[model samples]
Target: MTGFPGVRPRRLRALPALRDMVAETSVEARRLILPVFVGEGFTEPRPIASMPGVVQHTLDSLKRTAAEAAGAGLAGVMVFGLPETKDATGSQALAEDGVLTTALREVRAEVGDDCLVMSDVCLDEFTDHGHCGVLTESGVVDNDATLELYGEMAVLHAEAGAHVVGPSGMMDGQVGVIRSALDRAGHHDTVILAYAAKYASAFYGPFREAVNSSLQGDRRTYQQDNRNLRDALREIRLDVEEGADIIMVKPALAYLDVIAAARAICDVPIAAYNISGEYAMVEAAAANGWIDRDGAIDETLTSIRRAGADSILTYWALEYARRGATR
Candidate 1:
């Protein structure tokens, strides 16, 4: 055999400490944001059927959970409200005593300024039909009308003491509308995290269940089509132009390319949501003894971080934090 000269890449891989020293990505507890669902009128945390070990927390339980998250040094908690009532226009989304508003106030009061508080500024949770926007006279999502409602919701969230308002409704001009509303309401400091490259994905199935969504049809007409990469960039550009403090790509695992593209173009912090379906798949496989749960979770998060996400929203934040402490 001819002697090969030049390449010796395996040298670094031969040593465990060397591999750790050369690791390009790291997943830390402080870079993860836990998405918590707070439901109305529940005495105990209710397990979401689709997502194992994930729950819809009651207000009292949510307060305790938020305190625990703060103590664990998590970056933040993203709150989702499962309201008792639903309407065509999702009017409860802007009510002062609304489920989400109440949860936000309680969480903020409990955690004080120690942890960042973010609220989902979308109407799907409050809508009867489980769409993210208001219906037109002809019974379709009216984009402009939805932006108006989103603007109102942003201000409400800001007033409820949310440090950040995440607009995930996928409405055109939503970031601009929300930014304007917050500024006018003297909440200029409230950050806007736009779900810029969110696709019309089937991966949201578990999330729909988590929020008790009764979506009658698909949202492909409004959300970005999965096949279109250029469209995602366009959406990201628009949000950035309209003053998005941070931009995000949803269902991070499947859309690493979108996340990378957005990271390449945008100057702001990039976020990725490791959605519920992603969490469920890992948990199910682990439960069946198909994979090591902790290793799988760590690898998944590290992969997302390596794909250029500055922060990640995950259901595994608490578990990961607990595990990290022992390590």
Candidate 2:
């Protein structure tokens, strides 16, 4: 046969060592953050049905899990708390003894400085209506009012020893308000991971169940539209100007373009959330014997890294870290 004129691309893939050496993307265990749920009033860890192998943890269980993650060399753990009570104001969100703050303290104490402890600074998990912010008399989300509460929540989380507080509510000027709150409280060292471009995605279904969300309706008014790419960059700019230490793009798989675009313009570290729906889809396919579970996990994570994420928040972080360690 005549030799092809063009250079051969498959030579690099012909050998495993060559492929490894030529790999452009890698997922480091120390840069992966696991999202963990700690529920109030749970005597034992409660399994989330839609998300297999994930559980709503009690304080004791949360400690154990945090310990394991730290031991596995995972960078951090993002905590979402399920409070026992809900009200119009999401009062528990700012309460010193609230589920979230309490869990933050527990996790911080258990892991110490070995791992970064991050808490979700949003009211949705504590509010009766399940909206991210407080509502007005007409049932509309009051953006300004919500900022004040977010500020308060940020201070509380900082006091509780959260090394990083992620404001995931998509509220306007949230990053500035949170930064001010932390600084005023002498927590200037605490980092703010801004959910700079969160989309109102349908992929959040499993998360709602995981946090026992009491959402009455969709959050379209607050979250960014999934169709807008230019706006995502604008959001990143606002967050960066407002002193966000890191900017995040949520629903990582569906928003890889946004992550890549943000990486182009953003100077701060960029994070992408490998959201619940994305995890569930892989789990479901793997359970059905339609996909190689471990391979899919690595590919998806690698794709996110390749798309320009400095760090990834994923449910599979702990599992992948443990497996990666063994290998």
Candidate 3:
């Protein structure tokens, strides 16, 4: 076994300045993207119990937050909508004046190219059944039909001034459909950040509550299963071939290997989501005095960045960035 010889590695780790100088990965505000939730018709922001410290913002609050995020020098903000109504077809998702669309326009106006404006191009929040797509008569998610809706959603988001439209439904051919739709709609400059490796993980529990999900069944059929890493790579390749400008791996902490693998094979930028459940667990443990909260937050994000994520979507994005991310 080889050692550091005369240049002992232990000495390098002896001081904070040396540690900072030798850091292999950098986690900066420019690489952090905040995930924000906005709902229709609210006087003030509403707290989500499942995800403590996360709130569903009113339009006013959302715009203010967007300005603040820009000021914090964040990479961007990803918007998820909590619609006032739901339907089988998720019609509100395509509404010109819907919660998500309105939020996109307003956020873009507030930030004005200062930061990227991303929107979730999925039906889970708008659909009555809480599935990612419309169901067939036999109750199976219609993959092809769902692709059409995703295309519509992406086009709408692009038109509303989204810098990026993230298709997270995990439906086959979703990226192709969205790309075609956007091209037809003359949104050539819009970026598609495909959720190519989203898994059906237990980590999504807090997210369900955050979105007010009415899911009657599991998403195991469409979402990538936890057991399949090969499938994730395949999906990433497929999404890239289908015109994805960037690709994402959801609930990033548990899938660092996946992120690393994705970076190995992906030419486009790779994004990883630090999901709601992951955030909640840390908060809960911190509240119980089980860990140094700030240290944990810093470590959690650093690990993800080290694993090869070009960008990270985290609930702590705003807080961490505003605090200068000094660890």
Candidate 4:
């Protein structure tokens, strides 16, 4: 064989140590945040049908799960609530004894500051209509009225000891409203992780089932359209300007490009949500013996990190962390 004249990329590939040393991306337990669901009125964990392995956990189980995640050295746990009751105003969302608020307090007590506790600060779980905010007389989402509710929710979460409040509703000026509310409530140190580029994706199907969502229609009117890249960028920029401590793009796999772009433009950490449908697809395929479950998870998460996500929120976070510990 003729000698290569200008390039010799094979030399680095020939040595495993050299390849490892030069790896462009890596995923670690500390960079992964597990999303957990805690429900009121459930004495045991209730399985979510659409998401085979996921469950709506009772308060006791939720505390244990939070402790386990902290012991595993995972980044944190993002808690979602399923209230026992729902109404037009989502009254329970701001109540101190509400499902999420109570769960936050319990998880914080169990973990004892060992891990970060994040709360999902949206009204969908408590709202009868299953929209992210309160509705007007005409059944339209009232943006200004919703902002006031979001602000109240933020204060409630802060009081409940949430380390971070994830505003995933995609409401206009939500970050500013929540920030001001937290500051006024003497929670100035609390962080805001904005769902800056959340798209109205079909990938959230399993999530809806997990929270027992009764959504009457799609959220396309408020959530970013999947086809609009520029809009995503603009939203991210606006959130950053509005005091978001962390920025996120939901449904990580399909929107890696958006994650990369946001990473390039923003100074704050970028997070990607490896959403429910993504996890369900892997579980379904693995059950069918079409792929190695652990291998598929590692590859999928590695790709998201390589695409510039600083942290990832995934249902597989604990499993992946345990695997990494074994290795």
State the lDDT of candidate 3 residue by residue for 73-140, as single tens digits: 99999999999999998989999999999999999999989999999999999999999999999999
lDDT of 2 by residue, 1-327 (tens): 467756888989999999989999899999899999998999999999989999999999999999999999999999999999999999999889988899999899999999999999999998999999999999999999999999999999988999999999999999999999899889989999999999999999999999999999899999999999999899999999999999999989999999999999988999999999999999999999999999999999999999999999999999999899786
Cα lDDT of model 1 by residue, 161-260, tens digit: 9999999989999999999999999998999999999999888889988999979888988899989999999999999999999999998999999988
**Which candidate's TM-score is highest?**
2
The runs of at least 3 residues in candidate 3 whose Cα sits more than 4 Å from the true structure, single-residue gaps closed, are 1-7, 325-327
Tens digit of lDDT per residue, candidate 4, span 4-101?
A: 56578777888889998888899999999999999898999999987887899999999999999999998899999999899998999988899999
Estimate the overall C-alpha local distance difference test score of candidate 1: 0.93
The better-scoring model by lDDT among 2 and 3 is: 2
How many clashes (backbone N, Cα, C below 3 Å) per candidate?
0, 0, 0, 0
Best lDDT goes to which candidate? 2
**Candidate 1 weakest ten by summed lDDT:** 1-10
lDDT of 2: 0.94
lDDT of each: 0.93, 0.94, 0.93, 0.93
